[model samples]
Target: MLDSLRKAAGTWVAKLLLLLLVGSFAVWGISGQLVTGMGGNSVIVAGGTEVSATDYRLAYDRQLSVMSQQFGTRITRDQATALGIDNQVLAQLVAGAVLDEQARKLGLGVSRDRVAALTVEDPAFQGPDGRFDRNQFDYVLRQVGMRPEDYLTNREQVAVRQQIVEAVSDGLTAPDAFFRALALYEGEDRTVDFVVLPSSLVEPIEDPSADVLAKWFEDRKANYGAPEYRKISYVKLEPEDIADESAITDDQVAKDYEASKARYTTAETRRIEQLVFASEEAAQAAADSLKAGSTFDQVVAAEGKSMGDVQMGALTKDKVPDPAVAEAAFKLQANEVSPIIKGSFGPMLVRVTEITPETVKSLDDVKTEIRKALALAEANRILLDVHDSYEDARAGGDSLQDAATKLNLKVTTIDAIDRTAQRPDGTIVDDIPESAALLAAAFESEANVENDPINIGSNGFVFFEVEGITPARERMLDEVREKVVADWKVAEVAARLGAKATELEKRLKDGATLDTIAAELKLEKQTKRGLKRQADDADFGRTGVAAAFGVPEKGVGLTPAPTDGGQILFQVSEVFEPAGADASTLPEQTRTSLSQGLADDLLDQLVARLQAEYDVEVDQGAIQRALSF
Candidate 1:
C-alpha cells in the first residue's frame, strides 16, 4: 500500500494537483497578503472555505518528502523554497479552497455512502487476496501521516470537486474542422526538381594579399581566441585498482567453489518430438508405422501436420512439464522411440532426436575464476577503509599527492586542459577518471581551495585539485595563420556559390529547364517525389525542403546544402493534398489525443472561472510562519 502511494505520487495528475494547490505564497509578499491581519491559523481563505496553517504545513512536508525521494537526497528548507514548493503547495490549497467554495455555492455535495464506495474501491487498500483490507487502509494512511477522519473528509471534498470538473469537460471532442485542417497540414506532400551547386562550380578564389588577410584576421580575432585552461592533479581509488588475485589462497578458492558448485553445473537436455493420439491403440499404430518404414516426418505428414507442429524444442527433464512424458523421453537414446505411454494430456509416442549430457566443471577448472572473485569481494569490503585512511592523512594536513603516495595509490596530473578537456594543440586529453565531472569541478575551483571529492557511484571516488589556471586570450594572426587561410577560402567559396545559385534560380524562373542548368554546370539533376512537408532528406535538407514547399508550383528557390557550403536550387513540380478520407476515419490514438487536448482546455477555463468567482485570499504571513521550521 505504501509503495503504491509512492508510485502514484510521481504521476502527472499528482504533479498537476501539487502545482495547483501550492499557490504562489513565497512570491506573495507581505504587501500582497490579503488576509494578513485576519489572525487565527488560516493561511488561505476562499469565500467561506479556509485552509489552516496546520493543513498547509502538512501538504508542504508531503511535497518536500516526495521531492527528496525523487532526487535521492534530503532537500533542505532553503532548497524547497528555491524550488517554489511553498508556492506550489499554497497554490494547490488555494485552488482547492476556491473549488470547494464554488461547489458549496452550487450546492454540490457527496454522500457518505459515495465516499465509502470510493474508499473501498481504491486499489491501494487491497490485500494479497485482492480484496479491500481494513488493516491495509489504516496502515497506508498512518504511513502517509493522515488520520482516518482527515482522509475521509479530503476524499469527500475531492468527490464534490470532481462533479464540477466532469460537468465542464466530459463528452468534449475536437471540432471536425480543426481535425480536418490538421490532417491536411500533416499529410500534404510535394515533389521537386533540384540541382546542387558545389563550391567547385564557383570561379577559382586566389589567396588573399597579406594586408587583406591581416585585416580579416583582426575582424574575427575573437573566433580564434584560446579557451581558459586549468592544470589539475587527482587520485582515483577503485576496487579493481586494489584487488590482488595472488592474495587469495587455494584453500579459500576451494571453499568458495564447494559453496557454489551449482554455478558450474550444466543440466542435461534433449530435443524431443511428440505425437499424441486420442487413444493408446492409435498411438500404438503410429509407433508401428514409424518402426516399419515411415520416417517420423512422413508419419506427421500422414496425420496432416508438419514437424514444427510436433517437435518440442530442447528441454531438461524438469522442464518437460508432464512427469510421465519426462520419464519416458529421458530413458530413450538419440533417434530412439519410446513405446506408447499415457501422458498428462493423452497417449503419446515420444522420440529423442538429440541428447546433451550433464557436465560439472572440476574445482581445478574454475580455481582462478574463484580466486579473482574472492579478491574483488575482499577489495570491496576494505575500500571504505582505504578511503578513510586517505581522509585521515588529509586531516593531518598532508597534500593530495602525499596522501595518495602514502596509500600507494597513483596520482595523475593533467598539465593543461580546457573545459572541454582539450589540450592547447586541440587534442582531447585521454583516460581521466570521471573526465566530465572532474573537468567541471576543476574549472569551478580555485587553485588553493580545498575541493570536495567526486563520488563515482559505488565504483570509487576521485579527489582533484586545480594546480594552475591559464586565462583565455586572443591568438595572434601568426599563431592561427593556416586555420585563418582555410576559413577565408571557405567563406569566399560560400559567397560565390550563393551568387551562382541565385543566378540559376532566376534562370529557372525565366523558364529554363532544371536539366539544362545541371548539364551546363556538369552536375546531377535530382527529383524527389511524394516528399512530405516534414521529410528530412540527408542531401536536400529541411531548409531546402521548406523553401520548396514555400514556393508555388513551377517556382524556384535556393537553400544551403545540409553538408558542404554548396546551395540547392530547387523548383517545385507538384503539390498533392491528402486523400479523400474524412477526419472521422483518423486513427483512434489521434482522435483520443485531440479530444484530451480539448478536455484540458475546458478544465483550465473552468478553474479560472472558479478562482475569480471565489476571490481567493492568501495569508502570506501565516504561510511563512507555518514553513519556518
Candidate 2:
C-alpha cells in the first residue's frame, strides 16, 4: 500500500514518506536522555503540522545506520554533518509536514475500512501460509517500536496524501510533438567517406638545441616532480601462517577420510529418453516397433517428436521423477529399450542411451586433502590464543617488531611506497595484505604512532606503522631527459597532424573528392554507412561521429582518430531521416518514461506552491541538539 502511494506521489512526497517509513522500521528505542534534551521543541513547522525533535532524531539516526553499513564502520556526528545528512533529514521532514498540512486544509480523508484492508493485504504482515497473521502483525509493530494505533494513523495519512498527488499528476502524457522530435533526433542516420592520416605521415621532427630543451624543461618541471613516498612496516596474523599440515598424524587423516567417504564417491548416472502415451496399448505398440528392428529415431519421428523433446541428460536414479521409470532405466544396458512401464504421468517407453558406473576414490588419492583440511581446522582453533598473546605483549609496551619477533612471526617492510602503493620508479609494491585499507591507514599515520590493527574480515589482522617518509621534490632535467624528449616528440606529432587535417578539410570543402586525395597520397579511402548518433566504431570514434552528424549532407569535417594520434578527414555522403510513423505510436516503455517525467514536473510544481502557501519553518537549534549525542 505504501509503495503504490509512493509511486503515485512522484518524487517529493515519495522520498519524504519513504525515509519516514524506512526509519520507523529500521531504528528502534530513542534514549530517554535525548527526549529530555529536546524537551518541548518542534524541529519543523509547516502550517498546522509539526515535526517534533524526536522524529528528526529517529530519521537522522536511521540515515547514519545506513551509511555505517555501507562503509563497514560506525559514523560519528561530525562525519554525518560533513555528509550533509543532518540538513537532508531536516529537509525531508519539512516536506512531509508541508504535504500533511495541505492535506489537512483540503480535508482529504481515507475510510477506516480502506486502511484496514490495506494493512491486512500488506506482505510484511503475512504469515507462512501467505495470509495476514495476528502474531506476525503484533511482532513487527513491537520490533519497530510503534503501536497498532500509530501505524494505522500513519497509513491513513499516506493514503490521504496520495489522493492529492494523484489528482494533480495522474494520467499525464508528453505531447506527441515532443516524442516525434525525440525520435527524429535519436533515429537519424549518417554516411561518411573518410581518410586516415597516421602520425607516420608527418616528417621526422628535429631535436631541439640545448638552450631550447633547457627552457622547455624549466617551463614544465612540475610534471617531472616525484610523488611523496612512505616506508611501511607491518605484521600479518593469518591461519595459513600457522597451519602445520605435517603435524596432522596419519591416523587422523585415515579417520577423516573414512568419516567423509561420500566426498570422494561419484554416483552412477544414465542418459535416458522417454516417450509417454495416453494408454498402455499405444505404449506397447511403440515398444514392439523398437523390438522389430526399428530405430528409436524412427519411432520418435513417427510420433512427430524431435530428439530434444524426449532426451533427459545423464541423471542419477534418485533424480528421475517416477520410481517405476528409475527402476527400469537402470535395469537396461546401453542402447537397450524397455517395455511399457507405468510411469507417474502415464504409460511410457524408456531407453537408456548410455551408462556411467559409480566410482570411489582410494584412500591414497585424497589423503593429502584430508590432512590439509584437518590442519587448517586446528589452526583456526588456536588463532585466537595467538591474537590474545600479541595483544598482551603490546599492552606490556612491546613494539610491533618485538611482539612479532617473540611470537616467531615475520615483519615485512616496504622500502618506499606512494599513496597508490607504487615505488618512486613507478613499479607496484607487490604482496601487501589488504593493500587498499593498509595504504589508507599508513598515509594517515605519523612515523612513530602505534596504529590499531585492521581486521581483514573474521580470519586475520594486519598491524601496520609508518617507518619513514620521503617528501616529494622536483626531478632534475638530467634524471628524466629521455622521457622529456619522448613526450616532446608525441606533442610535436600531434600538432603536425592537426595542421595536415585542417589542410585536408579545406581541400575537401573546396570540392576535392576523397578518392582523388587518397589515390594521390597512396592512402586507403573508407566509407561508413548507417552510423547513428551513438555509433561506436574503431576508426570513426565518438568525436569523429559527432563531427559527421554535426554537418549537413556533403559537408566536410575533421577530427583526431580515437587512437594512435591520427586524424580523420571526412565528408558526409548521405543522411537518413526517421520513418514517417505516427508519433502517437511510441514504444510502451518510451511512453511510460515520458509520462513519469511529466508527472514528476507536476508534483514539483504542486509542492512548491504548497510550500509558499503554508510558510514552512525549520528550527536549526533543535536539530543540533537532537544530533549532539
Candidate 3:
C-alpha cells in the first residue's frame, strides 16, 4: 500500500493503479478475503468479490487528480466525461477486482506483519527524525482521507496480486530459433538497379479541344471542387488582457512573501539507511551488536546477508517508511547507528549517513516571483467578470461587434475559412483568435448560432458566431481550364509510362539487360546497394525499397515515384539473407528482446486463464450514474 500510495501521488500512470486499490478496499471490505455484493453498493462484481460505489468515487478522484497534475490543467467534469476518463477508471477498477478474486482463490495473501513492515518502510509517513511517526502517519491518512485499517488491508491485497504476477513470469525464456529468426530478418539487405521515369520524360501532348477538356473535367470533378467555407466573428477573452500589473503594489508582494514563507524556506533533511529483520529478537540482537561498536557490515555479515542488500536510499524524515526507524535515525548524529527499534517489518536498525542544513531566502530574493503570482491571481479574478459580462451581452442577442464594444474588447472576423482553416485560393487563413477552437465552433454551428464560450489553454475563453456560410460547388470547365489541361497531360504521361514499363518488364523477362535498355532510351541507370527494408533511400524512395525487397533475385519490377511525379523501373541485383546464429553467440540486446517477448507471452496467457476462471459482471447503469457529474 505504501509503494502504491507513493506511486499514486507522484505519477499519472500510477494514479490509476492507486485508485483501483482504494476502490478494492471499499468493495472487498477488510476481511482479507473476497466477498459478494452487499446490496446495490457494488458497482462491479468479479467472481465473488464486489466493488462498492464509495470505492469507485475514491478511485475516480485520485485518477482525476493525477491527470490534472500530469496535464498541468484543471480538467472540468465535462471534459473528463468527453475524454471517457470515467469509463477508463471503472475498467481499471473492474480489472483489479478480477485479479483480487483470483489471488484469494489461490490462497495467496500477504501476512499482516509483512504488510505492516512494508507500510512502515514507506518514506511518506516519516517525521523529521527519519523514522515512522504515529502522528505523521495519522495526519497523512487524514490528508488522503483513508482509514488506517483500510490502507493496511489494501496493501495486503497488493502484495498477494504481486505474488501471483511474479510466479507467472518466473523462469520464462524465449526459444533460440525465435531470437535467431528475428535478428536475421532485421539484418537482411537488398540491392537494385533502376531508372526513374518522371512525367516530363514523356513527350508533352498538344492542347485538347474545349469538348475534350470539359469531358476530362467531368471525369474527375471532385479534384476541382471547393469545400464549404464559413465567415465568422469572435471575441477572445484572455486573462493577460485583463491583468493590471500596476495594481500589484510592493505591499501586496510583501504580504504574499510573508504568507508563503514555507515556499522560500528549505527544511532540514537527514539521509538514513535501514536493515529490516524478520523477527524482533533477531533484530534486537543485531542492533545490540551494532550499538556495542560493531559495524553495519559486520552485523549484515552475521545475518548472512550483504550490506548492499540493506541500503535504502537517502530520504527526509517524512519520506521514510517506518515511524520508529525515522525517530531513531533523526536523533542520531552523522555516521551514528541507532539501536533496535520496533519496525513494521519487524525489528530494524537505522544509520544516519548525512544531514543537510535548512536555508531560507529573504523577501528581496523572491519578491519578483511573488508579485507576478499576485498579479496573475488578480487577472484570473478579472477574467471571470469579463467572461460573465460577455456571456450576458451575447445571451441578450447583441451582435458580436456590439458585445465586444460594450466589453471593451476587439472583434476579429474572417471573410472565409474552411474546416481546415484554408481559403478557396489554398492560402491558410490567419490572424484569427483561438484559431483551432474558433474553426471547430464555426464549422460545428449553423449560420447565426452563438456558441458557448470555449475554455482556452489555462488563460482564456473564445465566444464565436457564424456570420455566413458558402456551400461547396464543383468548378466549371472554363473556370478551371488550366488545371484540366494539366490533368489531361498527366494522365497521358502516366498511361505511356505504365505501358512502357510493362514493355520493359517483358523485355527483361525475354533476357534483355537493364544496361542495354538504358542505353537505348538515353536514360541513366542508377545503382543502389546494401539497402535494408527499413532504410530510407532517397534514390529508391520507400516504395522502391519495398519493391526491391519484394522482387526475386535478378527479377524486374515497377513502382510509382513518391514525390518527383514519376515511376521507377527497377531490377534486384543481389540479396543478403540473415545468417542463422545460435542464441548464445547473439548480442545482449537480442537476448533481452527475446526475454521480454517471452515474458509478455506468459503474462498474456496468465490473464487469459484468469478471465476464463472468473465470472465478471459490470454495472453499466451504475457507471453511467457515477460519471454523469
Candidate 4:
C-alpha cells in the first residue's frame, strides 16, 4: 500500500507545481497564548531548514490577505472551511519548501534577466502600456503580506518552475492521423433508441414454502441488514432569529438611507469614443477636429487611430479617476460632447450617448434590499461586540462565569461532538488552533464539564473544558439485530435471483430456446424492440435489456460479455456487427485519449526519475506532532 501510494503520488508531480489557487490563513487575536495542535502538540515538522514561528505567522498572514481579496470581504469560518483554505495554505508552504529543496539540489538558479523579464511582463505587475509598474505590484503585495523583494523572489521561483513545466509539456503532439480521428469523435453524436419496460409488467409469484425460503435465506444472509442511522439534535442560530424591529426605528433607517443614498440610487452612466495619438500634438489636433462638428466615429477613422472606447456604465466617482476631464465627461447630459480636455495623451474629447438619473424608490420597491442591509449591519455589530467583550474578559483573566456576567451572554454547555460531526450546537467550525480536522485532538474522555475553556471558531471562539470523553466502540450484533435481519432478507432475495439466473444458463447450455425457457418459468418472452446501442439510463431502467444482450446465439454462454450496465442475457438474433474500425481513421475521441495516455506516461517517467533523485525521510515524531489533531 505504501509503495502504491508513492507510485500514484509520483504520477501526479507534473501537475504539482501549478499554483492553481491561493491559500487562506486568517488570524484572530491570539489572547497572548499560542496553542499548538488542539492537543498542545506542535504543528510543525522538525526536519529541513528550521521552521520558525515568524515564518508560520507571515505565511498565514499572506494567505489570509489573498483570501480576503478573492472573497471581496472578510473570511468567515464557514467560507474558510468551504475552501479548505487553512489546509491549502499549509500545503502551499510545504510544496514550496519541497520544490525549493529540489531546485537547490539541482543547482538550478533563476537569472536576474529572466526574473526582470517575468516581473516586467507579468500582466499583474504591468500598467496599461505594458511597462513594469512597481507601484501596482507593491500595492497588491502590501495587501497579501509581502514586501516588493519577497514578491520578486516568489516571481523568480515561478519563472524557474515554468521552465520545468515547459520541459515536461513540450514536444507533446498527436499526429495528423490522430488529430483527424479526434476531430471526428469530437464531432460525433452517438444516438441511442430504446423502450423502457418496467417490472410492473411481471406477474407476481406465489409465496415460497418455508423450507424453500430457509434454503434461499442461507445463501443470502448479508442483505437482510438495515442501514445504521443517526438522530442528531442541534441548536441553530441564524441572523434573523435575534433581530428585533425595536433596533431599527424609521428615523434611524431614514438617516442611514440618506447617508448612503448614492449606493441606493440608480447611476447615470455613458460609453464614449476615445481616440489617443502617441504624439500629443496629433491627439490635440484630433480633439480640435472633433470640436469642429465632425462625428466621433468619422473623426476616429480619419485620424487612423484604432482603439475603441470602452462602454463604462453605472459608474461612480471612484469607478473612474477624479481628473477634470473624466469628471466633466461624466457630468455631461445625454448626447452631449464635452470641450477638448487636455491630459496625458494630449487633449481628449468625450461624447455622452446615454444617461440614467438618480431617483427615490418606494419602500415596496426596496424593502428586501433595505432589510438585508440592515440585517447584515446588525449581525456584524452584535457579533463584533460579542467577540470583543469575550476577548477583553479573557485578557483580564476573568473566570468564565465572570466573563459571561460581564458580557451579558449565556453560559452554555454542549453534548460531546466527535471530531467529524457538528458541535452539539450546529456550528460548522474550522482551524481549531491546531491541525486539520482537529478530530484526534478532541476526545470524549476530555469533554465532560469541569475544566478550562475551549477554543472554537476564530471570533466565534469557545474555550471548552473537558466535559466527558467517550471512547469509540463497535456495535455488538445483539445491539443491531433489526439491521442484521433486514440485511438477511435482501440477501435471500438476491440469492434466489442468482440461482434462477444460473439455472437458466445451464438449460440454455443444453440447447433450450429463450421462448421455451420463458414458457417453463411462466414468464413473458418480452424483448426490447429496435433498441439503439447506446440507450440512456431512462430507456434501460427496465431489468431485462441486459439479460437479453447477454444470451449467446451459438452457445450457452453470455454473448460478447459486455456489461453495458448490469447482467445482460443475450442470444444472437442475427449478426449486424459493426465493421472493424480503421485504426488510422479512428474518431477524434480515441486518438485524443491515446494522446493523453502518452502524455501521462511521459509525466510518469519524469516524476519517477525526479523522485529517485531525492532522499525523503519522514520524521514520525514531527509528523505526529504536526498532525496529531
| Local distance difference test, each candidate | 0.81, 0.80, 0.75, 0.48
* Model 2 vs truth, CA RMSD: 9.2
Report the C-alpha lDDT of model 4 over 1-629, residue by residue, as the tens digit: 11222233232211111232211111111111222443322233322323333444455544454555445688765676586555554544444444445566667788988778766765665677878687877765554556767666666765664555456655665677655554443333222221221222231334555575555555544543332222212111223433445567666667666777667676555555444455767666766776687777776677665435433444554556536556877778776767666655556666666666556676556655666678666865686566566668767786655666665554544444546545534465443333232334334324323233334444234443443455445544455445445555544444555455566667766777777776665655544444433343343443433433444434333321122222223344542333333455565576666766666566445434443343322232443343323
Residue lDDT tens for model 3, 1-629: 22334444564235424633542222221112233433476778777887777778777776676566556798888888886667666656765676789987887778789989977876776779889888877876665567888778777777777777667665667877877776676778887888877666576778888788878788899998888988888777887666666788998888888888999998778877778888988887887786688898788788888867877777777877888887888789988888777888877787888898778999999887887778778878788788888779877988788888987787778888798889877898776767787788778898987778777887788888899999998878777888789889878888887888888878977899888888888888988888998887787778778888787898899888777678888889888976655565578886886786677567556555555567566676665555554
The TM-score of candidate 2 is 0.64
Arrange candidates, best lDDT first.
1, 2, 3, 4
Candidate 1, superposed: residue stretches over 4 Å from native? 1-40, 208-220, 229-416, 431-469, 499-513, 542-557
Which 10-residue window of candidate 2 scores lowest in summed lDDT?
A: 24-33
lDDT of 3: 0.75
Tens-digit per-residue lDDT, 391-426, candidate 2? 899889998899999987789999899999899888
lDDT for model 2, please: 0.80
Collision count of model 4: 44
Tell me the tens digit of each residue's lDDT in model 1 across 176-292.
Answer: 888888888778888888888888887588888999899999999999999999889998889887888999988999999999999999999999999888787777778899879
